[model samples]
Target: MHLSVSCGIPLIAPCRSSVKLPPPSPGIFYGRAREIDHIIDLVLHKSPARVAILGPGGIGKTSIALTVLHHPDIQTIYTHRRFFVSCETVTTADGVVLELLTTFGLIHDPQQGILPQQVLLNHLQSLPGGILCLDNLETLWDVETRATEHLLTTLASFSQLTLLVTTRGSRRPMHVAWTRPFLAPIMPLSLDAALQTWDAICEVHNEYSIKLVHAVDCLPLAVTLLANLAESESSKMLWERWEHDKLEVLHTQDSDNRLSNIEFSIELSFRGPKLKDDVQTVQCLSIICMLPQGLHESRISLFADAYSQVLPKFRSSIALLQGLCLVYSSDDGFVRVLSPMRHYIQAHHPLPDHLLSQLANIYCDISLAVH
Candidate 1:
């Protein structure tokens, strides 16, 4: 049966099929109420809600998407039709289509002469409507841009279907009219939210906890890791370890998963297609990571002039870094890396001495100009 509204109320009943739903919303989520509400409103009230939740690695994009999927209002409308597919392991358009078929139990039969994509499309067409959450879509899109966009365009053709995507980086996949007032890339948690999360995890609220969160720039994953450590180690000891180890200490003992390890999370971005082999971009990022404050936007020309050899492609490199969510531009016009990312980059990818000298000379010129 199709979804219908009566008296401005949705009269659609939940699907009765026995398909298993995604896991419940996170047990200890905090600091994302506004985002959750916005996504819910769009899915329930807007037409063709093709929402892309983009952000850096470990920024809780998947968690936010999961919360929206399991939301009461969402459950009422899209019930058994909701599908959450992880594109984390797939690397091609065909791979994504295969994932969709697998999620829907529509195994392709070569003897039946039906393409996998067509099988998925036919299955969805039979349903009233549904929401598809493609988590970590960048794995496919970054590698096979053209074919992936074609697949997205075809998927977007379904007027009844709503698409929710969570991917690393600030850029959304092209070929769809994503909901207006585009959701900016998710930022670090507010101080209060960070502290609340810390206290909830470790049952402690003190100066060391406050300093610990700030030291990680209030990034949720980093805060969560350090808090987990706080459960066993004293807050003071954690802080002292942080002072020495930085991102190294932001992982659980003997665990290195991206969610639990801040360094692994940053490594994913650093080794992403955008920044992996781009020497100039890597150099630019290393410089930003070393800067105590950040590289100001206005200083681009000065830096370009001073470090002409290293920054030959300075502007594009900066854009690439921002697109990957490795660095961000603040309201103060300075582009900065998050503390966890800065620590990771500094420890693993330190700039060469000659390049550092060039950066220092530019700073010297800027200081002289100010005086």
Candidate 2:
């Protein structure tokens, strides 16, 4: 049974005239050609590509999704069937159905005795081989887990439909067999790509420009924000301000969008359901943020001893932080926060003095043992 919609209600054709257009292609995209190509291949070749682009906030998930939505081959295959739904403001499973209905130009008339989900499913059944892109789906998935799962499971059952989603954090919603060899969560851009993005914006390739990109760890949003600042503010001055201001230096006075403000973007993750009320996890993150070299996995036991009263399950706390994309394991086996995130944590949520002293003593003991 492709759809469960009853034959009693008249199936409505999608009103093309009222359909909303997808956002314009990201004008200055870089470093994601491989990801885009892989996604295209999955959607084009696979029976029903159920792909999720997962990552932390401000890491270019939306930009990559938008770029794929506008790809030439994707445009040729999906045509007007392509629907891009921004789930940033949506928080419920029903809300997702409504967004899809709105995107399809179908009016939900409760008086007609049709469930909105049925209306949506019926409409989708009418249009075969369509692609749906849900951007920033974490807003919905985090708050309404079971409901969202049921919704996605139902959607994935349509073998002719392709489902693509972008969400903050490292996990995709469960129950759906996402395409094999799942796409890894997006990471910070490479130095080369970061420099290209910087030069494109500021047009000044110098020592300071190189230093600026490195300072932000080549995060796309951070690079773009700082590059825009570099256009008017001298690189030297901006570098100095970065030392004092950190994320504040990347803010745009005129805009409140998370993408335009590094602080706001980090705050969203900090305030997400997983971390927002979890004091021990925040403190654990602060400890990692305080150490430039990061907290080694082996040393977590020592830190747990230091804060045993406050952080009884320190190992799980660190695991939660990593799962949330707040801290990552470095190539050197240390768990490190990105430079921009480190600065934000230090300035706004520094470790308590007593805990800092304990950590200092712990490190001092390690050094003494080494000698």
Candidate 3:
């Protein structure tokens, strides 16, 4: 379990077990104090477990995990043994294993023809009370299912190590045994959290700020991007521009990271296994985007029938969207599309002329029936 002083990685300290988590994320982090507290209790105070932070992209899953990693309580336990491996760029399970090995300075010989899984398990099992974080795991799991499954299975043996994973989908692959008991689903920031985030960054909270946050579905990424803009642009002007072209306004100018744009982030979720191959699901989402916010399921059925599909078929598509955290059901049974998703669908996947005409006619008929 010990790490040598000459490991060649400056990020690791010369302790028995050295920490190698990502540098703390820049800017104000809000609304996740409770989440951090809960994760700390689960990992440290409770039995060894694998915790999954499930949510839509850009919903701050990674941020919350990082916060928990650096928390005072976690620091006290895993002071020098915390490791973070981002699965965003890794395409295979072997890639993930190597990343972890490199993080811990446990390089294996490629010529030996030995799999990294065995080496990793042996090391982690012997290590004591360390934290291992795997972020954006969907990227690797989707392509390398068997390898990812094997990796998780091996890691499960390390009762002394706590494992954390984040993904955009609600369901973890069943093979991984990431059951409901260890699940932590993250939704958009609450209105208060969103506003507090805005004011914390811009030092101002006004009507326009509220409108801007709500317009973006109270997602933390959008709030931060727009709040950063509020420093220079007037709130009124920022809100107006967001309404006109939100996807562009949400783009971060500071970096070349393609996923920095809120639109890009949501689009990645659309590529989940269920929706990636289903054109009907995408079209249905676009049509749903055209409806008023919180539109009832029955109204959606009418619209779907006008387009020559039955209510059940439409509901199926909605279920797929909901599974991906692209939409949610309100307390009154209305389905609500997240705001960034609404704008993305409207801007990037607009319905054709025939669907648009039928949608309008269906709404008219419903309006008449209601009256």
Candidate 4:
């Protein structure tokens, strides 16, 4: 008797190869349940062409992505075909593609005269389903838009593959959105959620810890860093010092997770042309930081001398700042900076005394008139 294995003409197989995914956070991940649920729905059920976990650095975007990747639903569907590419170190479009291909184990040999792109396509076709997480994508997306677009367009052709990109900026590549892309904007954790995280890190809690956490605006990265420091110092001392010198306290020596430092995290988010090159936006951030949180939108016109003309350029700068996650809008149309960010700007780029005086006078007049 003879036995034979029969298969379809264009043979297919479940993916067995392992890929280098982002390292899971060693600490407990708190908050972000709603985000995780929504993203899982989008990728596993809604079937969007692409999804981006867009937020500022240290907002736990990477941690959230890792959570979704390891979710039981995601794991069952994608079946270990998950891969990750850290776009932070990736400088070019080719570098981005090579990273993805290498993660999927597609590049067997460079001298084989086979294109890595084609290899990726072939492997993707054979897989039942797959998920790719592109972390820190703004490194390339900001400078190499056209090239990034082409790269996304090519990868997005595979309906079975889901691309989950994380970036500090809100803009999506022009190519990937054949349909509406699922955007999960990560905000800072709430006070209660932040307390839960703090509880895990600290053996004690008090007014000082609560105040310090709120002062950092409940940002997970900032909370984690300070909580670690709380191990050695009293929470009151940390809060007092942080209040006295926010940037000095936030500056960390950990080179691996630069986000451990509030200054480093914000600086990382503001890289590339649209942000680093735009002096007006930088100036606007400095001005906004000086005011109380949630400054009225109309008050931005006060920067008459800061711009060539305040209307057009100031508006553009604010929009750019919002896109870069350096600023955000409240429901009342008031814009505000995060606490740590406000602290970062105050330390690094305080407004001129004359401007500060002018702003104070304007506020004084407004308060008097309102009364």
Each candidate's lDDT (Cα)? 0.81, 0.85, 0.75, 0.75
Q: lDDT score, residue 7, model 2?
A: 63
How well does candidate 3 score on lDDT at residue 162?
Answer: 82
Top TM-score model? 2
List, residue by residue over 1-371, the lDDT tens digit for candidate 4. Answer: 11122233333332334566656644678888898877887786667448878877788888988888888887787766777788888888878767776687654455655455555555666767788888888888887887787777767777777888888865666856734445546899998889888889896679999999988889999988888889889999998898788767866777545667677777776667787777667777887887786667776665543444433477777888888887888778889888888877777777767656666777787789889
Against the true structure, candidate 4 has what lDDT? 0.75
Better of 1 and 2 by lDDT: 2
Off by over 4 Å in 4: 1-18, 178-181, 301-312, 357-361, 364-371
Error of 2 at 21 (Å): 1.9
Per-residue lDDT, model 1, residue 340, is 81
For model 3, how does the per-residue alpha-carbon lDDT over 74-192 read when each residue is reduced to its tens digit?
78877878878998889877788778877886767656454455556556645767888899998887777777776776676567778888877776755555533565568789899
Best by lDDT: 2
What lDDT would candidate 2 get against the real structure?
0.85
lDDT for 120 in candidate 1 is 65
What TM-score do all the candidates reach, one by one?
A: 0.92, 0.95, 0.86, 0.88
So what's the TM-score on candidate 3?
0.86
Per-residue lDDT of model 2, residues 217-270, tens digit only: 999999999999999989888888987777888878756688888888888887
Report the candidate with higher TM-score, 1 versus 2. Answer: 2
As for lDDT, the candidate ahead, 1 or 3, is 1
